[model samples]
Target: MSPRRDDVIVIGAGLSGLMAARELEAAGRSVRVLEARDRVGGRTWTRSLRGHPIDLGGQWVGPTQDRVLALARELGIETYEQFDRGRKVMELGGQRSTYRGLLPWVGLGGLAELGLRVGQLELMARRIPLRAPAERADASALDGQTVRAWLDRRVRNPKARAVLRIATEMVFAGEPEDLSLLFFLFYMHSGGGFVRLTSIRGGAQAQRLKGGAQGLSRRMAEALATPVEHGQAVHAVLQEPEGVVVHAGNRSLRARHAIVAVPPALAAEIDLGPARSERRRRAEQGMPMGSVVKCIVVYPRPFWREAGLSGESISDGEPIRATFDGCSPDLSFCALVAFVIGGSAGGFGARPSEERRALVVEHLVRLFGAEAAEPVAYEDQDWSQEAWSRGCYVGLMRPGVLAEVGNVLREPAGRVRFAGTETAARWCGYFDGALRAGERAAQEVLEAMRAEVPGDV
Candidate 1:
């Protein structure tokens, strides 16, 4: 069957692309989705490792993330909460404090409370818009300062700082030193603040398709009655007087509109006809990729649980940095995921996979006793090294970027609209951001199609 021509061509089969295609298809418009990877889900990839489904790519969706939750529900996918079992351990100043029988803030109760107050204050600060918020008036105060700086001044407890640091690391996948406080604030605001974050149940908290995240994309494509052409890496996107032509391998696809949903850094490489605007260029220029190394270690068993440990640990030391009990609840499998971000992750990303695995093993053994060293399997995804990804995710404004060029990313460039975690107006670096961006881009395309006019070039 000749690829069914469409009114719009949705590039990338990631969540954003799939969502865009679905939206266009629902509007009585034919659509074709071109995916570069052989499988669906793009950045959200789940693979079988050690005879179990392991999501090595995008993982976890909060409850308040309406776009993703709505899509998951639409597809009949279910999510579970991440495990917060056992006692959490914290390592500070070369001292390991194991909370054998205590609350989460046992080690730093006062500081934890203080940090909550500061967090509440920061949350209030974010409600003000970047364009009109008083915070923006003092934007210069935060521009050059990193999350570390802001937290240090605002939060007195070292343990509290560590917790917040972990949150920042997981969310941005980079050092807080590289991300803007304003951008971070906006992120919290977008989700309606800390009170709203939710995870899948059983410490298995993440809305996973009954089959897998990949199944969600597959089902979405089926619902659209569109065959997603996989392994079709888009090379060039050219504009014609009548429509747009997309070159993917040897095949050329034409459509009245095209939604460019790849990473901003990657999307910027594709040449657009009529050229992109200064604002778009600024957005693209300001939009840089950040790095994060998600290392997964499959344990022979939940040894940490046996040790009266929560499988959650924070370190001011080496190797593992932080460890989480990523195992699915039923105790069927045990997974320990460690995140190395920014400059720290860079070193790990550059190292050979085997060496990196060894380093992780050493760290796990030290933190969780010797049992952690005997892993059934070990794997790591250096998202920065993945050519298609360039980096794990998009970078937040370094001080000046967002103040001067941030809004550009939120703006559309001609017939070419952008979608991805990076382009999200809400949560720019999380799975939620991808969902929001995809849904918003779909709405943008629908609105443009309705007007019977191409969107601003």
Candidate 2:
């Protein structure tokens, strides 16, 4: 039998879709959420690998994140502070250097401090819509330049440049060479920069999920009573006069409105009929996603603590981009997470899994010692492999793209609404942005529905 006609049909049960469904349901609207994957959390999933629950994707939350933190608080999900134990190690220009300060660079003592202050300034700058950042009007001044170029011009110290590159890669998911200076500046301003951004204290500040993010989504689904049909890949969307139809295999759903909660790259596949414009075509082509390869190697014990280092290392300009001491106090397990940004991750893609593990193990052994090489278990995720999510976070506009067509992908198209980390105004590419976009799209739909007039009983 055909299901009863619902008030709204939301596609993709990611953080955003769930949030939109929750809001719509709270307002007494009937809603159904559809997910392409067999799981509920979409991209944000956590599972027991080997033994520990290392987040496979979409980890970390911040206190400043009003939506996610509020949801966590409501669900009673607790968070733990990041375990930043010991001193950070630096590998630059083939020489290994150990630093005992807040930042990994030397002369950056002043520039890093300035960068912190600039991040604070950037947060305040968020008051101005990203569509028009004052500095952005002059594309030659900021837009045309890559983050690496901006940093190089600002910080004369090569070490400082390298440290900033690591931070940029972590945040933007791209190298300094490709990231826009205006984008980074706006990112800093929106969230108050590096220091304040890191201090969200359980919200942005901690990494514990209590049970992990997937649990939180389940609670949202239950509260909304929204049926999330999993393993159903939406092949096409056909808009009708009264409602829109979603197609996948032999199954199809018709709703008054459809939320395109999937990422831009994936959303490109959905045929919007005549509404699909060249702008979206360019967005699908121009926007970039990070080719990220994260390796989570857990040891029988926290051996790195004995190495007189913090277990965190930043490469000056090497393939071993960044490493951190992702260990708990019990010492039963130690996680060394290495982030390979831009072209750095390409080499590891074709390598065998065991070989990939061996490569990271060798890097750790070279810096921390042979003990670091031994692992009880290892887990890795290449987000690129995900058909649903082609890459991790949305790529920032390279030089020419942002200046010419900055808001092309963010605009709404007919009855189809877009949401995800990329559409958020504040934190455009973070998990927080994902939550923000979901909330914003939900509110937009709610207001629109409430304003609608009934046609028939």
TM-score: which candidate is best? 2
Model 2: per-residue Cα lDDT at residue 141:
66
Residue lDDT tens for model 1, 159-189: 6676666656755666777777766676656
Can you write out model 2's per-residue Cα lDDT over 1-457, one digit (the tens) per residue?
1466677778888887888788778777787788888887777788776556777676667656666777888888876666665777777677777776555545546556546644643554454456455334465466677777777676665556566667677666677787766666666655546655533243243555666678778787777765688887887777777777878767778777777888877888888888777867776666677777777888877777776676767774445677766665455557877776667777775678998888888888777778876787888887777888877756556665555656666676777777877777666666667778887777777766666755421
How does candidate 1 fare on TM-score? 0.87
TM-scores vs. true structure, each candidate: 0.87, 0.89
Q: Give each prediction's root-mean-square deviation over alpha carbons.
A: 3.9, 3.2
Error of 2 at 120 (Å): 11
Regions of model 2 farther than 4 Å from truth: 1-3, 107-128, 131-136, 139-141, 196-205, 454-457
lDDT of each: 0.70, 0.70
Off by over 4 Å in 1: 1-5, 99-117, 130-136, 152-163, 194-211, 453-457
